[model samples]
Target: MKTAIVGAGAMGQLFGARLQLAGTDVVFLDTNQATIDVLNARGVTLQTESRTEHTPARAARASELDETFDLFIIFTKGFHTQAAVASIAHLIGAESCGLTLQNGLGNAERLQEYFGPSKTLLGVTDFPADLSAPGMVSSNSRGKVRLGALGNVPRLPNIAQLLDSADLHAAVEQDIRIPVWEKVAFNAALNTLSAVTGLTVGGIGADPHARGLVASVLEETLAVAGRLQIDVSRQRIEAALDNAFAHHTHHKTSMLMDREAGRPTEIDTIGGAVVRLGQDNGVSTPVLATLCELVRTAARPGDNR
Candidate 1:
Protein backbone atom coordinates (compact mmCIF):
# COMPACT_ATOMS: atom_id res chain seq x y z
CA MET A 1 0.00 0.00 0.00
CA LYS A 2 1.09 3.55 -0.59
CA THR A 3 1.07 5.03 2.87
CA ALA A 4 1.71 8.56 4.09
CA ILE A 5 2.56 9.27 7.71
CA VAL A 6 1.12 12.62 8.71
CA GLY A 7 2.99 14.28 11.58
CA ALA A 8 6.30 12.53 11.15
CA GLY A 9 7.65 13.38 14.54
CA ALA A 10 9.05 10.67 16.78
CA MET A 11 6.24 8.18 16.36
CA GLY A 12 5.96 9.03 12.68
CA GLN A 13 9.61 8.33 12.00
CA LEU A 14 9.42 5.11 13.97
CA PHE A 15 6.43 3.72 12.10
CA GLY A 16 7.53 5.16 8.76
CA ALA A 17 10.96 3.57 8.99
CA ARG A 18 9.56 0.22 10.04
CA LEU A 19 6.98 0.17 7.31
CA GLN A 20 9.58 0.98 4.68
CA LEU A 21 11.94 -1.66 6.07
CA ALA A 22 9.12 -4.15 5.72
CA GLY A 23 8.82 -3.15 2.01
CA THR A 24 5.77 -0.89 2.06
CA ASP A 25 5.81 2.24 -0.09
CA VAL A 26 5.77 4.84 2.67
CA VAL A 27 6.37 8.59 2.55
CA PHE A 28 6.34 11.25 5.24
CA LEU A 29 4.28 14.45 5.41
CA ASP A 30 5.50 17.20 7.73
CA THR A 31 5.55 20.97 7.89
CA ASN A 32 9.07 21.21 9.26
CA GLN A 33 11.52 21.87 6.48
CA ALA A 34 14.32 20.49 8.59
CA THR A 35 12.48 17.24 9.10
CA ILE A 36 11.67 16.98 5.44
CA ASP A 37 15.22 17.84 4.38
CA VAL A 38 16.71 15.40 6.85
CA LEU A 39 14.37 12.63 5.76
CA ASN A 40 14.77 13.31 2.06
CA ALA A 41 18.55 13.41 2.40
CA ARG A 42 19.45 10.45 4.65
CA GLY A 43 16.11 8.93 5.66
CA VAL A 44 15.53 8.06 9.34
CA THR A 45 17.18 6.10 12.12
CA LEU A 46 15.07 4.05 14.49
CA GLN A 47 16.66 3.06 17.80
CA THR A 48 15.28 0.54 20.18
CA GLU A 49 16.53 -1.08 23.37
CA SER A 50 18.41 -3.70 21.38
CA ARG A 51 19.74 -2.16 18.20
CA THR A 52 19.09 0.41 15.49
CA GLU A 53 17.89 0.27 11.89
CA HIS A 54 18.11 2.86 9.13
CA THR A 55 15.53 3.10 6.40
CA PRO A 56 15.50 5.18 3.22
CA ALA A 57 12.63 7.70 3.24
CA ARG A 58 10.78 10.32 1.21
CA ALA A 59 8.86 13.36 2.41
CA ALA A 60 6.94 16.35 1.14
CA ARG A 61 4.87 19.17 2.44
CA ALA A 62 1.10 18.66 2.23
CA SER A 63 0.78 21.39 -0.38
CA GLU A 64 3.44 19.69 -2.43
CA LEU A 65 1.63 16.35 -2.43
CA ASP A 66 0.55 15.67 -6.03
CA GLU A 67 -0.85 12.18 -5.72
CA THR A 68 -3.41 10.21 -3.78
CA PHE A 69 -2.44 7.56 -1.25
CA ASP A 70 -4.02 4.35 -0.02
CA LEU A 71 -3.74 5.35 3.60
CA PHE A 72 -2.89 8.28 5.82
CA ILE A 73 -1.90 7.54 9.42
CA ILE A 74 -2.10 10.64 11.58
CA PHE A 75 0.42 10.95 14.40
CA THR A 76 0.15 14.69 14.88
CA LYS A 77 -0.43 16.19 18.31
CA GLY A 78 -4.06 16.57 19.41
CA PHE A 79 -4.16 20.34 18.95
CA HIS A 80 -3.00 20.07 15.34
CA THR A 81 -5.37 17.29 14.35
CA GLN A 82 -7.95 19.40 12.54
CA ALA A 83 -5.56 21.51 10.52
CA ALA A 84 -3.22 18.63 9.80
CA VAL A 85 -5.97 16.44 8.37
CA ALA A 86 -7.53 19.28 6.49
CA SER A 87 -4.24 20.18 4.88
CA ILE A 88 -3.77 16.63 3.63
CA ALA A 89 -7.35 15.60 2.98
CA HIS A 90 -6.71 15.90 -0.71
CA LEU A 91 -4.45 12.88 -0.56
CA ILE A 92 -7.16 10.57 0.70
CA GLY A 93 -8.68 8.86 -2.30
CA ALA A 94 -12.18 7.49 -2.53
CA GLU A 95 -11.13 4.00 -1.52
CA SER A 96 -8.39 5.24 0.76
CA CYS A 97 -8.67 5.38 4.55
CA GLY A 98 -7.39 7.52 7.40
CA LEU A 99 -6.21 6.11 10.69
CA THR A 100 -5.33 8.04 13.82
CA LEU A 101 -3.13 6.45 16.48
CA GLN A 102 -2.89 9.78 18.24
CA ASN A 103 -3.36 10.20 21.96
CA GLY A 104 -6.28 11.81 23.81
CA LEU A 105 -10.00 12.00 23.08
CA GLY A 106 -11.87 13.65 20.14
CA ASN A 107 -9.28 12.51 17.62
CA ALA A 108 -11.60 9.84 16.37
CA GLU A 109 -14.32 12.44 16.05
CA ARG A 110 -12.01 14.73 14.15
CA LEU A 111 -10.97 11.97 11.79
CA GLN A 112 -14.58 11.04 11.29
CA GLU A 113 -15.45 14.63 10.53
CA TYR A 114 -12.84 14.71 7.81
CA PHE A 115 -12.99 11.18 6.45
CA GLY A 116 -16.39 9.94 7.53
CA PRO A 117 -16.93 6.80 9.59
CA SER A 118 -16.70 4.46 6.63
CA LYS A 119 -13.32 5.80 5.63
CA THR A 120 -11.87 6.30 9.10
CA LEU A 121 -10.09 3.89 11.43
CA LEU A 122 -9.26 4.41 15.09
CA GLY A 123 -6.11 2.91 16.50
CA VAL A 124 -3.97 3.16 19.64
CA THR A 125 -0.40 2.08 20.16
CA ASP A 126 1.10 1.10 23.50
CA PHE A 127 4.54 1.64 22.10
CA PRO A 128 6.48 4.29 23.96
CA ALA A 129 8.08 6.56 21.36
CA ASP A 130 10.51 9.43 21.63
CA LEU A 131 11.91 11.63 18.88
CA SER A 132 15.42 11.80 20.25
CA ALA A 133 16.58 14.07 17.45
CA PRO A 134 15.41 15.59 14.21
CA GLY A 135 16.12 12.50 12.11
CA MET A 136 16.34 9.95 14.88
CA VAL A 137 13.43 8.19 16.59
CA SER A 138 13.10 5.48 19.19
CA SER A 139 10.23 3.27 20.18
CA ASN A 140 9.19 0.17 22.10
CA SER A 141 6.58 -0.67 19.47
CA ARG A 142 8.08 -3.98 18.54
CA GLY A 143 4.65 -5.41 17.73
CA LYS A 144 0.93 -5.00 17.36
CA VAL A 145 -1.34 -2.02 16.68
CA ARG A 146 -4.81 -2.11 18.26
CA LEU A 147 -7.25 -0.93 15.60
CA GLY A 148 -10.98 -0.80 14.92
CA ALA A 149 -13.42 0.89 12.59
CA LEU A 150 -15.45 3.87 13.69
CA GLY A 151 -19.22 3.78 14.14
CA ASN A 152 -20.92 0.92 12.26
CA VAL A 153 -18.46 0.82 9.41
CA PRO A 154 -17.61 -2.73 8.57
CA ARG A 155 -14.15 -3.82 9.54
CA LEU A 156 -11.65 -3.17 6.79
CA PRO A 157 -9.61 -6.31 6.56
CA ASN A 158 -7.31 -4.66 4.04
CA ILE A 159 -6.07 -2.04 6.49
CA ALA A 160 -5.13 -4.61 9.14
CA GLN A 161 -3.67 -6.90 6.51
CA LEU A 162 -1.47 -4.17 5.10
CA LEU A 163 -0.14 -3.22 8.53
CA ASP A 164 0.47 -6.85 9.37
CA SER A 165 2.34 -7.34 6.13
CA ALA A 166 4.53 -4.43 7.16
CA ASP A 167 5.16 -6.29 10.41
CA LEU A 168 3.36 -3.66 12.45
CA HIS A 169 1.55 -6.22 14.66
CA ALA A 170 -1.97 -5.24 13.73
CA ALA A 171 -4.89 -6.47 15.80
CA VAL A 172 -8.49 -5.52 15.27
CA GLU A 173 -10.82 -4.69 18.14
CA GLN A 174 -14.58 -5.00 17.66
CA ASP A 175 -15.07 -2.05 19.92
CA ILE A 176 -11.91 0.05 20.07
CA ARG A 177 -13.59 2.54 22.38
CA ILE A 178 -12.34 0.45 25.30
CA PRO A 179 -8.65 0.89 24.44
CA VAL A 180 -9.21 4.54 23.46
CA TRP A 181 -10.71 5.40 26.80
CA GLU A 182 -8.19 3.26 28.64
CA LYS A 183 -5.28 5.13 27.04
CA VAL A 184 -6.94 8.54 27.50
CA ALA A 185 -7.67 7.83 31.14
CA PHE A 186 -4.12 6.67 31.68
CA ASN A 187 -2.75 9.87 30.15
CA ALA A 188 -5.26 11.97 32.04
CA ALA A 189 -4.17 10.42 35.29
CA LEU A 190 -0.37 10.64 35.16
CA ASN A 191 0.63 12.89 32.24
CA THR A 192 -0.82 15.96 33.90
CA LEU A 193 0.83 15.11 37.19
CA SER A 194 4.19 14.68 35.51
CA ALA A 195 3.79 17.99 33.70
CA VAL A 196 2.59 19.86 36.77
CA THR A 197 5.00 18.36 39.30
CA GLY A 198 8.06 18.32 37.02
CA LEU A 199 8.60 14.69 37.92
CA THR A 200 9.28 11.58 35.94
CA VAL A 201 6.67 8.86 35.68
CA GLY A 202 8.35 7.02 38.50
CA GLY A 203 8.49 10.08 40.67
CA ILE A 204 4.76 10.56 40.38
CA GLY A 205 4.20 6.93 41.24
CA ALA A 206 6.50 7.17 44.25
CA ASP A 207 5.20 10.33 45.81
CA PRO A 208 2.37 9.81 48.26
CA HIS A 209 0.81 13.18 47.53
CA ALA A 210 1.04 12.83 43.75
CA ARG A 211 -0.23 9.28 43.78
CA GLY A 212 -3.23 10.34 45.81
CA LEU A 213 -3.99 13.13 43.39
CA VAL A 214 -3.64 10.79 40.41
CA ALA A 215 -5.96 8.28 41.98
CA SER A 216 -8.60 10.96 42.41
CA VAL A 217 -8.26 11.93 38.78
CA LEU A 218 -8.54 8.33 37.73
CA GLU A 219 -11.66 7.77 39.84
CA GLU A 220 -13.32 10.83 38.44
CA THR A 221 -12.45 9.88 34.84
CA LEU A 222 -13.60 6.32 35.30
CA ALA A 223 -16.85 7.50 36.77
CA VAL A 224 -17.43 9.65 33.74
CA ALA A 225 -16.49 6.76 31.45
CA GLY A 226 -18.91 4.48 33.24
CA ARG A 227 -21.70 6.97 32.78
CA LEU A 228 -20.96 7.16 29.07
CA GLN A 229 -21.07 3.35 28.89
CA ILE A 230 -17.76 3.38 27.05
CA ASP A 231 -16.89 -0.06 28.46
CA VAL A 232 -13.88 1.35 30.29
CA SER A 233 -13.02 -0.54 33.44
CA ARG A 234 -11.51 1.11 36.48
CA GLN A 235 -9.45 -2.00 37.12
CA ARG A 236 -8.06 -1.83 33.59
CA ILE A 237 -7.00 1.82 33.83
CA GLU A 238 -5.51 1.23 37.28
CA ALA A 239 -3.56 -1.76 36.11
CA ALA A 240 -2.14 0.11 33.11
CA LEU A 241 -1.19 3.09 35.29
CA ASP A 242 0.48 0.84 37.83
CA ASN A 243 2.35 -1.04 35.13
CA ALA A 244 3.68 2.19 33.55
CA PHE A 245 4.66 3.71 36.86
CA ALA A 246 6.52 0.60 37.91
CA HIS A 247 8.28 -0.03 34.62
CA HIS A 248 8.76 3.48 33.27
CA THR A 249 9.55 5.44 36.39
CA HIS A 250 12.19 7.63 34.82
CA HIS A 251 10.30 8.13 31.60
CA LYS A 252 8.91 11.55 30.84
CA THR A 253 5.34 11.77 29.67
CA SER A 254 4.36 13.40 26.37
CA MET A 255 2.78 16.20 28.34
CA LEU A 256 5.97 16.86 30.30
CA MET A 257 7.95 16.91 27.08
CA ASP A 258 5.57 19.46 25.62
CA ARG A 259 5.64 21.58 28.74
CA GLU A 260 9.42 21.63 28.70
CA ALA A 261 9.50 22.46 24.99
CA GLY A 262 7.05 25.28 25.67
CA ARG A 263 4.72 23.64 23.19
CA PRO A 264 1.01 23.25 23.78
CA THR A 265 0.36 20.10 25.73
CA GLU A 266 -2.82 18.14 25.14
CA ILE A 267 -3.97 19.25 28.56
CA ASP A 268 -7.46 20.16 27.49
CA THR A 269 -7.92 17.09 25.36
CA ILE A 270 -6.76 14.73 28.08
CA GLY A 271 -7.60 16.27 31.46
CA GLY A 272 -10.03 18.95 30.39
CA ALA A 273 -11.99 16.42 28.38
CA VAL A 274 -12.43 14.37 31.51
CA VAL A 275 -13.74 17.36 33.41
CA ARG A 276 -16.17 18.26 30.65
CA LEU A 277 -17.59 14.75 30.47
CA GLY A 278 -17.87 14.73 34.22
CA GLN A 279 -19.96 17.88 34.17
CA ASP A 280 -22.15 16.65 31.34
CA ASN A 281 -22.66 13.39 33.15
CA GLY A 282 -23.55 15.16 36.41
CA VAL A 283 -20.36 13.86 38.00
CA SER A 284 -18.01 16.17 39.83
CA THR A 285 -14.37 16.01 38.81
CA PRO A 286 -12.91 18.59 41.14
CA VAL A 287 -9.44 17.14 40.87
CA LEU A 288 -9.52 17.01 37.08
CA ALA A 289 -11.09 20.45 36.99
CA THR A 290 -8.27 21.95 39.00
CA LEU A 291 -5.71 20.15 36.90
CA CYS A 292 -7.18 21.65 33.73
CA GLU A 293 -6.82 25.19 35.04
CA LEU A 294 -3.38 24.65 36.50
CA VAL A 295 -2.05 23.12 33.35
CA ARG A 296 -3.57 25.80 31.17
CA THR A 297 -2.17 28.49 33.42
CA ALA A 298 1.22 26.88 33.35
CA ALA A 299 1.36 27.05 29.56
CA ARG A 300 3.29 30.00 28.28
CA PRO A 301 1.35 32.66 26.40
CA GLY A 302 3.31 32.54 23.16
CA ASP A 303 2.69 28.79 22.83
CA ASN A 304 -1.12 28.99 22.71
CA ARG A 305 -1.59 25.98 24.98
Candidate 2:
Protein backbone atom coordinates (compact mmCIF):
# COMPACT_ATOMS: atom_id res chain seq x y z
CA MET A 1 0.00 0.00 0.00
CA LYS A 2 1.18 3.49 -0.73
CA THR A 3 0.64 5.30 2.59
CA ALA A 4 0.76 9.01 3.36
CA ILE A 5 1.07 10.14 6.96
CA VAL A 6 0.16 13.76 7.51
CA GLY A 7 1.86 15.82 10.21
CA ALA A 8 5.56 14.94 10.53
CA GLY A 9 5.35 15.02 14.31
CA ALA A 10 6.42 12.25 16.64
CA MET A 11 3.58 9.87 15.93
CA GLY A 12 3.61 10.62 12.21
CA GLN A 13 7.34 9.93 11.92
CA LEU A 14 7.10 6.86 14.12
CA PHE A 15 4.34 5.30 12.05
CA GLY A 16 5.97 6.23 8.75
CA ALA A 17 9.34 4.85 9.81
CA ARG A 18 7.92 1.56 11.06
CA LEU A 19 5.74 1.16 7.98
CA GLN A 20 8.70 1.86 5.73
CA LEU A 21 10.84 -0.69 7.55
CA ALA A 22 8.06 -3.21 7.08
CA GLY A 23 8.43 -2.59 3.31
CA THR A 24 5.34 -0.45 2.87
CA ASP A 25 5.84 2.50 0.56
CA VAL A 26 5.39 5.33 3.10
CA VAL A 27 5.48 9.03 2.41
CA PHE A 28 4.76 12.00 4.65
CA LEU A 29 2.77 15.13 3.84
CA ASP A 30 3.63 18.02 6.10
CA THR A 31 3.67 21.79 5.80
CA ASN A 32 6.97 22.00 7.60
CA GLN A 33 9.58 22.40 4.90
CA ALA A 34 12.46 21.74 7.26
CA THR A 35 11.03 18.39 8.34
CA ILE A 36 10.29 17.45 4.73
CA ASP A 37 13.86 18.30 3.69
CA VAL A 38 15.32 16.32 6.57
CA LEU A 39 13.09 13.29 5.95
CA ASN A 40 13.76 13.19 2.21
CA ALA A 41 17.49 13.71 2.73
CA ARG A 42 18.65 11.70 5.78
CA GLY A 43 15.59 9.54 6.51
CA VAL A 44 14.84 8.61 10.14
CA THR A 45 16.46 6.56 12.88
CA LEU A 46 13.76 4.69 14.80
CA GLN A 47 14.75 3.48 18.26
CA THR A 48 12.71 1.47 20.66
CA GLU A 49 13.69 -0.10 23.98
CA SER A 50 14.59 -3.41 22.38
CA ARG A 51 15.97 -2.40 19.00
CA THR A 52 16.86 0.36 16.58
CA GLU A 53 16.42 0.55 12.83
CA HIS A 54 17.14 2.96 10.02
CA THR A 55 14.15 3.64 7.78
CA PRO A 56 14.17 5.59 4.55
CA ALA A 57 11.40 8.15 4.08
CA ARG A 58 9.82 10.37 1.45
CA ALA A 59 7.85 13.57 2.07
CA ALA A 60 5.99 16.21 0.12
CA ARG A 61 3.88 19.21 0.76
CA ALA A 62 0.28 19.17 -0.44
CA SER A 63 1.23 21.12 -3.53
CA GLU A 64 4.16 18.87 -4.37
CA LEU A 65 2.23 15.62 -4.04
CA ASP A 66 1.16 14.38 -7.50
CA GLU A 67 0.48 10.72 -6.79
CA THR A 68 -2.64 9.14 -5.39
CA PHE A 69 -2.48 7.31 -2.05
CA ASP A 70 -4.25 4.16 -0.97
CA LEU A 71 -4.12 4.95 2.72
CA PHE A 72 -4.16 8.38 4.36
CA ILE A 73 -3.20 8.12 8.02
CA ILE A 74 -3.82 11.36 9.86
CA PHE A 75 -1.50 11.93 12.80
CA THR A 76 -1.96 15.67 13.02
CA LYS A 77 -3.22 17.44 16.10
CA GLY A 78 -6.99 17.55 16.47
CA PHE A 79 -7.18 21.29 15.94
CA HIS A 80 -5.29 21.05 12.66
CA THR A 81 -7.46 18.30 11.23
CA GLN A 82 -9.42 20.47 8.81
CA ALA A 83 -6.45 22.34 7.39
CA ALA A 84 -4.41 19.16 7.13
CA VAL A 85 -7.12 17.39 5.19
CA ALA A 86 -7.68 20.35 2.92
CA SER A 87 -4.00 20.38 2.15
CA ILE A 88 -3.95 16.81 0.87
CA ALA A 89 -7.51 16.12 -0.24
CA HIS A 90 -6.38 15.84 -3.81
CA LEU A 91 -4.26 12.79 -3.02
CA ILE A 92 -7.18 10.70 -1.77
CA GLY A 93 -8.11 8.21 -4.47
CA ALA A 94 -11.42 6.53 -5.25
CA GLU A 95 -10.34 3.43 -3.36
CA SER A 96 -8.47 5.32 -0.66
CA CYS A 97 -9.14 4.89 3.05
CA GLY A 98 -8.62 7.56 5.67
CA LEU A 99 -7.54 6.68 9.18
CA THR A 100 -7.11 8.95 12.16
CA LEU A 101 -4.67 7.64 14.79
CA GLN A 102 -4.77 10.87 16.67
CA ASN A 103 -5.81 11.85 20.17
CA GLY A 104 -9.19 13.18 21.38
CA LEU A 105 -12.70 13.44 19.89
CA GLY A 106 -14.52 14.56 16.71
CA ASN A 107 -11.76 13.10 14.56
CA ALA A 108 -14.16 10.77 12.85
CA GLU A 109 -16.37 13.65 11.86
CA ARG A 110 -13.43 15.69 10.58
CA LEU A 111 -12.07 12.78 8.59
CA GLN A 112 -15.50 11.87 7.29
CA GLU A 113 -16.08 15.41 6.10
CA TYR A 114 -13.38 14.91 3.51
CA PHE A 115 -12.89 11.17 3.25
CA GLY A 116 -16.55 10.14 3.42
CA PRO A 117 -18.19 8.67 6.51
CA SER A 118 -17.97 5.05 5.49
CA LYS A 119 -14.46 5.45 4.09
CA THR A 120 -13.07 6.87 7.33
CA LEU A 121 -11.59 4.73 10.09
CA LEU A 122 -11.24 6.31 13.50
CA GLY A 123 -8.76 4.91 15.98
CA VAL A 124 -6.71 5.66 19.09
CA THR A 125 -3.18 4.79 20.21
CA ASP A 126 -0.97 5.10 23.29
CA PHE A 127 2.31 4.45 21.55
CA PRO A 128 4.36 7.00 23.39
CA ALA A 129 7.12 8.52 21.28
CA ASP A 130 9.24 11.62 20.96
CA LEU A 131 10.99 13.30 18.06
CA SER A 132 14.50 13.45 19.44
CA ALA A 133 15.71 15.51 16.52
CA PRO A 134 14.86 16.35 12.90
CA GLY A 135 15.13 12.75 11.69
CA MET A 136 15.28 10.91 14.97
CA VAL A 137 12.27 9.42 16.76
CA SER A 138 12.09 7.12 19.76
CA SER A 139 9.15 5.03 20.88
CA ASN A 140 9.33 4.86 24.64
CA SER A 141 6.86 2.03 25.14
CA ARG A 142 4.96 -0.48 23.06
CA GLY A 143 1.37 0.32 22.24
CA LYS A 144 -1.14 -0.56 19.60
CA VAL A 145 -4.05 1.25 17.93
CA ARG A 146 -7.77 0.39 17.75
CA LEU A 147 -9.50 1.31 14.52
CA GLY A 148 -13.14 1.02 13.51
CA ALA A 149 -14.98 2.21 10.50
CA LEU A 150 -17.22 5.17 11.19
CA GLY A 151 -19.87 3.44 9.13
CA ASN A 152 -20.21 0.20 7.19
CA VAL A 153 -17.10 0.43 5.08
CA PRO A 154 -15.77 -2.43 2.99
CA ARG A 155 -12.14 -1.36 2.98
CA LEU A 156 -11.86 -1.55 6.77
CA PRO A 157 -10.06 -4.88 6.68
CA ASN A 158 -7.73 -3.63 4.00
CA ILE A 159 -6.81 -0.66 6.21
CA ALA A 160 -6.22 -2.94 9.18
CA GLN A 161 -4.02 -5.23 7.11
CA LEU A 162 -2.03 -2.22 5.94
CA LEU A 163 -1.12 -1.40 9.53
CA ASP A 164 -0.70 -5.06 10.38
CA SER A 165 1.97 -5.25 7.69
CA ALA A 166 3.82 -2.49 9.49
CA ASP A 167 3.65 -4.39 12.79
CA LEU A 168 1.32 -1.75 14.15
CA HIS A 169 -1.41 -3.63 15.92
CA ALA A 170 -4.41 -1.92 14.41
CA ALA A 171 -7.27 -3.87 15.88
CA VAL A 172 -10.68 -3.58 14.25
CA GLU A 173 -13.39 -2.48 16.63
CA GLN A 174 -17.13 -2.88 16.23
CA ASP A 175 -17.89 0.07 18.44
CA ILE A 176 -15.08 2.60 18.39
CA ARG A 177 -16.90 5.76 19.45
CA ILE A 178 -17.15 4.52 23.02
CA PRO A 179 -13.41 3.94 23.27
CA VAL A 180 -12.73 7.33 21.75
CA TRP A 181 -14.95 8.89 24.40
CA GLU A 182 -13.27 6.90 27.14
CA LYS A 183 -9.80 7.96 25.96
CA VAL A 184 -10.82 11.59 25.75
CA ALA A 185 -12.32 11.42 29.22
CA PHE A 186 -9.07 10.01 30.46
CA ASN A 187 -7.18 12.84 28.81
CA ALA A 188 -9.59 15.41 30.25
CA ALA A 189 -8.70 14.16 33.70
CA LEU A 190 -4.95 13.70 33.31
CA ASN A 191 -3.73 15.84 30.41
CA THR A 192 -5.55 19.00 31.44
CA LEU A 193 -4.40 18.77 35.06
CA SER A 194 -0.79 18.09 34.11
CA ALA A 195 -0.70 20.79 31.46
CA VAL A 196 -2.10 23.46 33.77
CA THR A 197 -0.11 22.54 36.87
CA GLY A 198 3.24 21.77 35.24
CA LEU A 199 3.17 18.41 36.99
CA THR A 200 4.12 15.01 35.73
CA VAL A 201 1.44 12.32 35.58
CA GLY A 202 2.81 10.92 38.86
CA GLY A 203 2.75 14.27 40.55
CA ILE A 204 -0.91 14.76 39.74
CA GLY A 205 -1.72 11.14 40.52
CA ALA A 206 -0.15 11.40 43.96
CA ASP A 207 -1.82 14.60 45.01
CA PRO A 208 -5.14 14.23 46.82
CA HIS A 209 -6.38 17.62 45.65
CA ALA A 210 -5.51 16.77 42.10
CA ARG A 211 -7.27 13.47 42.45
CA GLY A 212 -10.44 15.28 43.48
CA LEU A 213 -10.07 17.50 40.44
CA VAL A 214 -9.69 14.43 38.27
CA ALA A 215 -12.77 12.85 39.77
CA SER A 216 -14.82 15.98 39.17
CA VAL A 217 -13.90 16.20 35.51
CA LEU A 218 -14.31 12.47 35.03
CA GLU A 219 -17.73 12.38 36.66
CA GLU A 220 -18.85 15.18 34.41
CA THR A 221 -17.59 13.31 31.37
CA LEU A 222 -19.30 10.14 32.49
CA ALA A 223 -22.50 12.03 33.00
CA VAL A 224 -22.29 13.41 29.50
CA ALA A 225 -21.52 10.02 28.02
CA GLY A 226 -24.38 8.42 29.89
CA ARG A 227 -26.84 10.95 28.51
CA LEU A 228 -25.82 9.87 25.03
CA GLN A 229 -26.35 6.19 25.90
CA ILE A 230 -22.67 5.42 25.46
CA ASP A 231 -21.54 2.53 27.64
CA VAL A 232 -18.74 4.31 29.46
CA SER A 233 -18.29 3.90 33.19
CA ARG A 234 -16.69 5.98 35.90
CA GLN A 235 -15.20 2.76 37.23
CA ARG A 236 -13.54 1.82 33.95
CA ILE A 237 -12.00 5.25 33.38
CA GLU A 238 -10.95 5.66 37.03
CA ALA A 239 -9.27 2.29 37.04
CA ALA A 240 -7.32 3.28 33.95
CA LEU A 241 -6.21 6.40 35.80
CA ASP A 242 -4.93 4.34 38.72
CA ASN A 243 -3.07 2.05 36.35
CA ALA A 244 -1.57 5.04 34.57
CA PHE A 245 -0.16 6.35 37.84
CA ALA A 246 1.60 3.06 38.39
CA HIS A 247 2.85 2.35 34.86
CA HIS A 248 3.17 5.73 33.19
CA THR A 249 4.30 7.76 36.17
CA HIS A 250 7.25 9.30 34.43
CA HIS A 251 5.50 9.89 31.15
CA LYS A 252 4.38 13.33 30.11
CA THR A 253 1.18 13.49 28.13
CA SER A 254 0.93 15.03 24.65
CA MET A 255 -0.64 18.13 26.17
CA LEU A 256 2.31 18.58 28.50
CA MET A 257 4.70 18.08 25.60
CA ASP A 258 2.87 20.72 23.56
CA ARG A 259 3.15 23.15 26.43
CA GLU A 260 6.88 22.46 26.75
CA ALA A 261 7.31 22.93 23.01
CA GLY A 262 5.38 26.22 23.19
CA ARG A 263 2.80 24.75 20.84
CA PRO A 264 -0.95 25.12 21.23
CA THR A 265 -2.66 22.12 22.73
CA GLU A 266 -5.75 20.05 21.87
CA ILE A 267 -7.44 21.21 25.02
CA ASP A 268 -10.39 22.15 22.83
CA THR A 269 -10.60 18.61 21.53
CA ILE A 270 -10.40 16.89 24.92
CA GLY A 271 -11.38 19.11 27.82
CA GLY A 272 -13.09 21.68 25.71
CA ALA A 273 -15.03 19.00 23.89
CA VAL A 274 -16.17 17.53 27.17
CA VAL A 275 -17.56 20.85 28.29
CA ARG A 276 -19.27 21.39 24.96
CA LEU A 277 -20.83 17.97 25.02
CA GLY A 278 -22.01 18.54 28.56
CA GLN A 279 -23.65 21.80 27.51
CA ASP A 280 -25.20 20.18 24.45
CA ASN A 281 -26.62 17.42 26.57
CA GLY A 282 -27.72 19.77 29.33
CA VAL A 283 -25.13 18.36 31.71
CA SER A 284 -22.88 20.75 33.59
CA THR A 285 -19.08 20.41 33.46
CA PRO A 286 -17.77 23.10 35.74
CA VAL A 287 -14.44 21.39 36.37
CA LEU A 288 -13.61 20.87 32.71
CA ALA A 289 -14.77 24.38 31.88
CA THR A 290 -12.42 25.98 34.38
CA LEU A 291 -9.52 23.83 33.30
CA CYS A 292 -10.22 24.66 29.65
CA GLU A 293 -10.24 28.36 30.39
CA LEU A 294 -6.97 28.21 32.30
CA VAL A 295 -5.28 26.15 29.62
CA ARG A 296 -6.40 28.42 26.80
CA THR A 297 -5.29 31.47 28.75
CA ALA A 298 -1.88 29.99 29.42
CA ALA A 299 -1.48 29.03 25.78
CA ARG A 300 -2.18 32.50 24.50
CA PRO A 301 0.71 33.66 22.37
CA GLY A 302 3.13 36.37 23.54
CA ASP A 303 1.81 36.47 27.05
CA ASN A 304 4.52 37.74 29.40
CA ARG A 305 2.50 37.29 32.56
Each candidate's lDDT (Cα)?
0.86, 0.86
lDDT of 1 by residue, 42-151 (tens): 88988878888898899989999789988899999898999999999788788777899998888878888877889899888876677777778887646568999767
Q: Pick the candidate with the highest TM-score.
A: 1
lDDT of 2: 0.86
* Candidate 1 residue-pair clash tally: 2
Angstrom error at residue 100, model 2: 0.7
| Model 1: per-residue Cα lDDT at residue 79 | 88
In model 1, the worst 10-residue window by lDDT is: 149-158
Clash counts for all predictions: 2, 0
lDDT tens per residue, model 2, 80-99? 99889988888888888888
The regions of model 1 sitting more than 4 angstroms off are: 141-143
Model 2 misses residue 3 by how many Å?
Answer: 0.8
